[model samples]
Target: MSKLRVGVIGCGSIAQFRHLPEYAASQEVELVAVCDIVEDRVKEIANKYGAKAFTDYKELISSGEVDAVSVCTPNYLHAPISIEALNNGLHVLCEKPMATSQEEADAMIQAAQKNDKKLMIAHNQRFVRSHQLARQLIESGEIGKIYSFRTAFGHPGPEGWSVDGKDSWFFVKEKAYIGAMGDLGVHKTDLLRYLLGEEIVEVGAFIETTAKEFADVDDTAVCALKTESGIIGTLAASWSYTAKEDNSTIIYGEKAIIRLEDNPAYSLVVQYTNGETVNYELGKIQSNDEGGQQTTHVINHFVSAVVENKEPLITGEEGMKSLAVILAAIKSNETKTIAKVFE
Candidate 1:
């Protein structure tokens, strides 16, 4: 069996922690190239993965050795790099919130369609065991009609996560586009959409810069969303947290309420109207090479999908769907009006 050759763009924290390691661990993948604007970082990653290094992403995309590429770059670069790789006849696994704007996301989709290559997004929360179980429960109608919900993702800050800390692109609006909303909020947004199997039609948001002195972007954000099915919910994401909390969701239903959390053990807890509560331990949730290793699980899923010639658990369209909500939230914050997602 031939290994799938992969070129990874952006040797940043995400690429180093989540993607590069996962690609290395994949039985069906061979890391063929690593690219980054920072030459030293790319060289280091390439050496670590035993792959060719390039400062120019175009070189990696044009390199005939690569069958796929992971666009693990800053938020602004996600669409352009992914589209380029797809147009180059290579499969793409792009990091979320898909792109900086809906227009960019549309272009990426079009590029994938034009190239006839698979495009997946790194919304790894969809692959988490507890989250998946929650989706199954909702789909089974075991929770009855969901009335309202809340999803939140919080981390201390990206300073510790990045090699450059406050100097990282995360603090720059040009690179990150949006702050917590784009980085952490999009994860919960995607998870909520996936678990509920619903579309967020409208969103009202409030954004704040609570901490991190040099950061001009939002450090925290809160948004209220209305699903197409009339289900209402709140999504909160923050980098101002003193203590970290992984992704969490609470679903309220007629018969029961479901609660899922990422820490203190990845599990789902259900509370029934009759006052009976059931606890389910989902063991380990899929993660990256970062704190929880969630990215590893997500990357494995992408590789598996390619090797099996099947669609990934989170397709590019699904990623775009999640991005739609995030973009709507940003718009809502800007206009101080509830922005309709599909518009």
Candidate 2:
């Protein structure tokens, strides 16, 4: 098959460090165009990669210069750009939080289905080796009958990682939609659901803008989630882990307790009910503060799916289900009540 020509919209941090570089590295992909409001950013990236540069995403989409595009724009633009690309007969690997609302997410999914194009969400947590291994152990009854779990994804905040730092769109309410919940929370929400292989049916949460007083969005959020199988868990998303980043999960089961990325020394550790223990060093989990790039596997997976005419692991529907948990948590926070997911 011919190389899949690709364009990337949004020259932000994720685009600069993840999408653009990954596409450039993929032999099966041709990095054909780049779009961002910041003209200089796109020009530099385009020149470096020998791709067309555009300030307007609409122009990039209609330029007939690419077969697919990565929607790495801010949260608000995710659904719109992806829908436009899908409708224009191009595949889309959209960045996470996928959309600010379920209505928009639904539209994106519909557009891809109607156009017969691929729409993959960039939820990279599921691609981590430790996470994949953890899921397998649970499925194989290594950790029999998962009873509960606690997962968290936290860091100092987007200020250090964002291209514009303190004044970046990440801290803007209108552009970002939600802060930590959408930024970090949705990842754990998606990861937990994937590992448990269950749909989160209900949620109640306490979300607050405790840190980053300059920001209007929530900086800390704690959610109580209950799955369809009656398994319950807690999820914490925060931008206030001042000292260090914490991206880990602990699952309790009848047979054993599985720990993922919780220990710096070990990627995954299993403790059995019979006082037996096992440890595995899978690989490193991607980090924003590491000042280095780890192949997220998200780009590779999406590219292969599009090229092979196969369904991706995290499709629009799967993205929506994950986003629903956060959306429900938001609703629950406002109403001070438990919210039923997918209602």
- Best-performing candidate as measured by TM-score: 2
Candidate 2 stretches greater than 4 Å from native: none
Question: What TM-score, to 2 decimals, does candidate 2 have?
Answer: 0.99
lDDT of 2 at 343: 83
TM-score of each: 0.96, 0.99
Per-residue lDDT for 236-343 in model 1, tens only? 899877664556789999989988873465378989999998888777554322464554477887888878888887787888889888888888888999999978
- lDDT, model 2: 0.94
Shift in Å, residue 163, candidate 1: 1.6
Instruction: State the C-alpha lDDT per candidate.
Output: 0.85, 0.94
Cα lDDT of model 2 by residue, 247-339, tens digit: 999999999999999999899999999999898988778898777488899999999999999999999999999999999999999999999
Which residue pairs in candidate 1 have backbone atoms (N, alpha carbon, C) closer than 3 angstroms, thus clashing?
286-294, 287-293, 287-294, 287-295, 288-293, 288-294, 288-295, 288-296
- Return the top candidate by lDDT: 2
